[model samples]
Target: MPSKSSARLAALTVAAVCSAASAVALTSPAHADSVRIHDIQGSTRISSYAGQKVTDVAGIVTGVRTYGSSRGFWIQDPNPDDNPATSEGIFVFTSSTPKVAVGDSVTVTGTVSEYVPGGASSGNQSVTEITKPTVTTVSTGNAVPAPTVIDAKSVPARYAPAGDTAASGSINGLTLQPSTYALDYYESLEGMNVQVADARVVTATDPYSELWVTVKAHEHRTPSGGTLYGSYDSQNTGRLQIQSLGATADFPKANVGDMLTGTTAGPLDFNQFGGYTLVANQLGTLKSGGLQRETTKKQSRGELAVATYNVENLDPSDKTFDAHAAAIVNNLQSPDIVSLEEIQDNNGATDDGTVAADVTVNKLIDAIVAAGGPKYDWRSINPVNDQDGGEPGGNIRQVFLFNPERVSFVDRAGGDSTTAVGVTKVHGKAQLTASPGRIDPADDAWKSSRKPLAGEFVFRGRTVFVIANHLNSKGGDQGLTAQYQPPVRSSETQRHAQATLVNAFVKSILDVQKNADVIALGDMNDFEFSDTAKILEGHGELWSAIKSLPKSERYTYDYQGNQQVLDQILISPSIRRSCKFEYDSVHVNSEFNDQISDHDPQVLRFRP
Candidate 1:
């Protein structure tokens, strides 16, 4: 489960900027024709004359960001330059609120430097800036530069530059090729006045006062016209970030499949937040898609309903418990068995010796019961104090909540947080030697991650194996908003290993009984079209049930205006062969602004 605090922290990490040098006082006034803004901002990602002192760099102050440590005003050249590759605007890092007005024609004398937001360790591109600026007002009430129109024809078809490797790792290492790639196209326009006309919203508006839009018709548009967040192989080339430089109330609220009508014109500013964003003074009108909250149909009697949900760090102190319980009851229709993730300890985020989540789970169960749902029995093995990675002191782990009236748990001895589960044959049937046990807790792949909870259950005299997993999240991975070409998913390496381990365990059960009804599901933290999912569904040993949905409607998570799949239910060969199973990604959360969790729970109803 991705926490909003963590997401905001990541945004802050990207937004982090280097300390500015001492400000130089405006001692001398020079001619405005001495240096052009385009000359200062060359055709490359970095300034050609970086570290060199340039005098009398003249432009009209277009915008100002006075809030953060990197308080500065953006200046753009009013005169037109014939070279399409060279940007006419640049950011003057003043460190404090600039004294210049927005329409004031300013002449700045400063040293050009390439400042990397988030520092160099972040691997993000450097933003060309004029540091230690000495500002002089050339003229007042000057007209700003006309924004360059960015439409379908202006944006390149290729989204990113192909460096030495197939995927562009970092644009900072390679030279800029604006004509060839869309990233370079935007990079070339960095800090320049730009406009996106009639942009189609791809991602929903996030808490960061930003939204992603595509100027052109994308190839992977969803049924509702939102862009599908495909694999790393498919890039949304024309996608641009629309950032509001005004108050939060001014930022438009939009969902996937919505449109930004009229033209959004602003300066193209590069930062670690969302790569190249148009810092618009005013946003376009949000055209409603009329997308409403969705509910899954109730399960029939005798049908076993299993679901996987990442409750987003459920704790006794959190207020979202009732909402989550209502979602599980009314939206997921009170699944017979639910594989829950991120169940925090009794003390919640307290660093006390307590590692039990009994109180937390009980509160959710109580809420579910109050919501008119059946009383559910729960089971979970608390991880060693802070061994599993999540919010500090939270001690989050996987848990199971099952309706005892509908299904029965087969608990046996030797089940604990540290012991690994073993399988055996009973009456020529596959059965866990220790039901409700951990799967390979000592395995290297499970290090600093949630160990899978494997539980054996009986429904209508038939046995089923369920594994609840919360794999390593994509926290350390490069974002889609990064400067890299296709972007790097460094977080997948551990998830791939984790999937392999889970697959091996699933194989052990299937090897004992070839038609074993096994389900491995939870917040995988990877996509259905990802390599992690591929490894889990190796050679048809397990079938990803999410793929069974229409390609456009398969996502359970909404990210960056793209509906993506991060939660999944993978079934064994017997379940796939039965063809009697039904799966639904109950869209009660994720899409809505008032979402209880960052993910939407998925329910699979089948007759075994």
Candidate 2:
């Protein structure tokens, strides 16, 4: 034997050389041709080679994601086969820092897999990928492939396929009909480079460096020249998501109705957030819409103004109290009686046994007085610990704040947090047995959700029954960018039930008194054209006050580039026949980046 140190070095060199030889041996194909990228990414939504080992997969590295948990690089074939439905590019999962460059040509050996983000409950589509890859570089400095153009001519006018049920819902089993539906068209261009030109902004730019756009001219436009969210039957086909690939500061800030000149070139990707996003490195110039904030004029004397506002999670610890008060005072014209929602308890998300909102409501009233507004008297019942469905530890409830000089509260006994209010005929008039009481609190529709608060108020010698409500939200529903065609709205079932209950209560009041001066208002968390609204308007029990305005000017909230109605005020037949009501949606929030609340309050001035 040789010396001790020399012998050890010789053994280590032998092991290293054997390791290099093993990698080449495992990756090299004996006599067969190399596997193409399209074969790995099949024509269907999922790959045919999933859960199988594949060798000699040749492609060029097109993109690299060096950060995050799912660190990987995307590879595309330099010469694509003649398969129109199959994609030529696929993602390789590394689970660490990526080791390849953008222009490197390589042959990879790995196991094919289908990765679903956030598990099965998310209802998101799975992405086909290669895991635990072994790479062998062949060349470098090659030219990238050209991007495919997507215009109005390329996309289909239809939205999705019919007869797809929620129990067995997927596009993987169906054939790709790119010329028939928008969802099919996007699936066909799944992992390819694409370009869009002369797009119109349909939604405002969000905080996540993303915006929605429509490539073609739209038929439905709002009064401000923005795109209107039509009914569910009319699907906006050419709509797409534009996501920035550069620094956050480099992205453009745009509002609805704005235009983007030139083209945006990027790779088409599907993720859990927004279904099909264009990850663009190059963006065009943004043309502004020149939209501005609006304020409503003050109400005339002797005209009682009733308003509804959703103060988003107001509490004592929050610092947005002054701004909200100013908006209510100046923008809303200091309404005589205001119904507020999302008012948290005194300790504000502390989770202790504190259920009183006196401190929270008092702070807002003090702020309003300092802003040169009149004194307001607030009334609300403290909720039991944490039954409401909202932020944890924050006991949120509905509250009413009124100008004591203009409107007087009609108080009665036997009203508590859990007691259900009963309706009765008093002197031939429908009246609440317990004023300011909860409506049907024991009903299944109100389980773990906000209960309707009913109050009787006397304004100018007329008694008006006001019911404050905040219904179930759209949290579990699919987004506008979901993979499924005509994305299913699963949250509507509960909202429909809630609407039925509210309709029954209204009918009870109208049965005793045909023309009861009823005004039901608050955050009804559904669209104006939704089924919930239809049930609320059944048999002409109440009319949506917002509908009295022109169609082009009937939105109280802005979300995802669509100005839609979420908060509404419904009036009785008597109120509608009068036609002496003036309605205004005070635009102090919902359009600007710096917003006090996510909603714009509504003020209805009528001589009751």
List the candidates' TM-scores in order: 0.93, 0.88
List model 2 lDDT by residue over 1-608, tens digit each. Answer: 00112333333222111122122112222232356878867676666676667888988877666644556777788788887677787777777777788788988888776665433444555666777888888998876667678888988888666525653655555666777877777877766777888787766676666777777665466755455565676556777788755676888887666777798877676665556777675687898877676777777876879999998889999999999888888888789889999899998879898889999999999999999888999888778788776666778899999999889998988778889887799898888888889888777887778888889899888888888988888766766645454566787888789889888888888998998888888888887788888888778998888887877788777665566788899888888888888888776676654566778899898877
- Poorest 10 consecutive residues by lDDT, candidate 1: 22-31
lDDT of 1 at 464: 92
What clash pairs does model 1 have? 202-561, 203-561
Best by TM-score: 1
Q: Which residue pairs show backbone clashes in model 2? A: 203-561
Off by over 4 Å in 2: 1-34, 163-167, 480-486
Q: Model 2 has how many clashing residue pairs?
A: 1
Give all candidates' CA lDDT scores. Answer: 0.82, 0.75
**Against the true structure, candidate 1 has what lDDT?**
0.82
Model 2: ten consecutive residues of lowest lDDT: 15-24
lDDT of 2 at 269: 68
